[model samples]
Target: MNYQTFQPHPDLEALIKCYWTLEVPAEPAATKQRILPDGCIEMIFILGDDVKRYTSGEEYILQPRAMLLGQISEPFFVEPTGVVSSFAIRFYPYSFANFTTTPVKDLANRETPIRLLFEEKLAADLEHAIVNAADTQERIRIMDDFFLQRLKEEIVIDSILKSTIDTLLSAGGSATTSSLLKGEVSKRRQLERKFSKQVGLSPKQLGRIIRLQTALKILLNQPDESLTSIAYESQYYDQSHFIKDFREFTGVNPKEFYGNDELALSSLIYT
Candidate 1:
């Protein structure tokens, strides 16, 4: 397996984490891989064979050549179809709402074709460009061009929502909704309604995820640091609270996670 990631354009840096590509050679035997939630959404274009996401023994559906996986709230299994090649854009939880009218929160635990959320022509063209790209560099360039163009075509974002997200992210989720809203309680409520309608998750949920992100980075970077210190730095109420939230998001305690080989790839991504 080979995986590579690239930085997004400056204009998109606030919302987009990175663009990535993955390639795996065909295997003689079938294998399954588990994907854990990381509080982000992704738009994926399959460049080679298909991929299947399973929820236990049942298969959901073979992802189309190009699809957007909404925010995943739970762990899931994926089976690559023979040799697999794919490129994806990882969007910050709030960043995805900037592009489409489709409610992202509604997409939890779902992978749907991009056409469902975007115009058919744009989605088709983007998929074609990705699948035909000569190499990872070319793929990255194509995606950059595509995102820049599509961004220009999107509807104007709500100023309230934009400011709210900016405040939450800047505060590292330590700020309360009331403080973030300040003199706009009604507007804040309206924003949460819109967030749920458009982003598929409430503002509080995204904030929790963002907070977890910060905690993970600290834990990974300062392996020798005590959990109590990490909890305080991460703004959790206490060590127990920190551990509970960490386990909720990652399905493992910090100590166990540090030693899990299967989690190594995911740890690298999040940390």
Candidate 2:
């Protein structure tokens, strides 16, 4: 398995978190890999072979070769159907809204092909460019060129949505939405509506996912960190609360996750 991440171009730094790629050699036996939410959105291109995303034990679907995955609220399962090689763009929670008008909430937990999001011809051309590129850097140039074009359109991102996500991310999801704003009960409701349309999840839900990402990063990097210490660092109320939230997002306890073979993809990507 090989995983690497690249910084975004200077001009796109505010909207994009980073670009990433993963390559895993083909194996003799297939294994289901668990994927957890990280409080962001991604545009993925499968450059090697198809991958299967399971909806249940007995059912699954092939992920689109070039597609967008929106804010994920729960853990999901996926396995490689062949050699796994993919390149993707990770966007900050509220920034993808600048690219299209598609209600982000509608894309939750699933992917939509790029063609569906852009004109068929334009999407096809972009995919063609990436597929025909000689290497990863070339691929990045292709992707960057495409987004740079979209950037010129000058889409408006809602101010409340931007500052709210900034607070959630900066605080590692520790701050409450109410505290981020002034007195007014209805203000929270209004923010939720914009968040759903623009960021794909309520402010509270996005916060939880971001918090889990924080804890997951600690576990992945510092193997010696105790669960209790992780909980405190992530600002969970208690170990129980931390365990409950971890289980909710990852479908497993921290102990099971530490050395689990099934988490190879998760560990490699998050680490």
Candidate 3:
């Protein structure tokens, strides 16, 4: 397996987190890999063989070749049908809304083909460019051109939404929503509505995902640390709370997650 991430063009740094690529050889026997939510949206292009995303016990669906993967509230599993090659753009929770009018909430928990989000011709051209690009660098240039064209339209991101996400990120997701609104009940309701339309996940859910990411990095970097210590460092209420959130988003306890083969892909992204 090979995974790498590249920084986005400086002009797009505020909205795009990074561009990433993954390549893996086909394995005769493959286990379902669990994907955890990381409080962001992604535009993905599958450049190799197909992959399956399980919808339920023993049920699955083929992910779109070019699609937008929205904010996921829970963990899901995917398995490759053959060699895996993919290129993707990770968008910050509040940034994806700047490019499309589709209500972000409508995209949650599923994959929507690019055609559904953008005009068919535009989506097809983007996918063709991605698939035919000579290499990763070429792909990056293609993406930069595509997004930069849209960025020129100068879509204005809502100030309230941006500030809320900024506060959540700066605090490592420990900031309370009420505190962000300064105990203003009306503002809290308005924020919730905007978060649904623009960020998909409610502020509270996004916060938990952000916090989980911090804990995951600690676990990956400090393998010897106890769960209690990690919980303290991550600002969870206690060890049990940390374990519960871990299980909720990762589908396994911390002990099981460590050294687990199925988590290699996820570990690479977080590490």
Candidate 4:
């Protein structure tokens, strides 16, 4: 297995987190791998054999060759059908809304084909360019051009929404919306609506995912750290509360997650 990430062009740095690539040689006994939420959206292109995303036990669908995956609130499973080679763009939670008018909430937990999001011909052309690119650099250039074109002359990101997301991130998702809003409590409803459309998640939901990601990174980097210390550092109320959120997002407790073969793929990405 090989996994790598690249920084985005400076112009797109605010909207895009990074570009990533993953390649894995075929394994005769590949098993379904669980994927946890990471508080971001992604545009993925499968450059090798198809991969299967399990909808339920024994039921799965082949992911689109070029697609946009929305914010995921729960854990999901996927398995490689053969050699795996994929390139993807990870977008900031509040920034994807600048690229399209489609409410981000509509995209949650599902892979929407690029054709459905953009003109069919345009989407097809972009996919063709990516698939035929000579190298990762070429693919990155193609994506940069495509998104930069779609970017509107006036990028209207909500100031409050952006600030709220920033606070959550900087505070490791421990910041509360009420405190962020301060005296303007009436804006809570409006903020919720804005969050739904721009972020594909309620502020609380994204915060929880962000917090879990923090804990996960600690677990990956410091494998020997006790769960209690991790929970405290991550701002959870207690070990039980931390375990509850862990199970909610990852579908497993910290103990089961560490060194689990089924989570090897997820571990790689989180790391």
Q: After superposition, how far is residue 271 of candidate 2 from its true place, in Å?
A: 1.8
- Alpha-carbon TM-score of each model against the true structure: 0.84, 0.96, 0.97, 0.98
Model 2, 150-248: lDDT tens per residue?
889786768777888898889999888778775666788788888888888888888888898899999999989989999999999989999999899
lDDT of 4 at 150: 73
What would the per-residue lDDT of candidate 3 be over residues 105-222, giving only the tens digit for each residue? 9999999999999989999999999999999999999999888999998677788789889999988898898888978967888899999989998999999999999999999999
lDDT of 4: 0.91
lDDT tens string, model 4, 14-103? 899999999999999997889889889999999999999999889999999999999999988999999999999999999888887678
Best candidate according to lDDT? 3
Q: What is the TM-score (0 to 1) of candidate 3?
A: 0.97
Off by over 4 Å in 4: 152-154
**Which candidate order results from sorting by TM-score in descending order?**
4, 3, 2, 1
Which residues of candidate 2, in runs, are more than 4 Å off? none
How much lDDT does each candidate structure score? 0.78, 0.89, 0.92, 0.91
In candidate 2, the residue pairs with backbone N, CA or C atoms under 3 Å apart (3 or more residues apart, or in different chains) clash, namely none
Give me candidate 2's TM-score against the actual structure.
0.96
| 93: Cα error in model 3, Å | 0.5
Residue 151 of model 1 has an lDDT of: 83
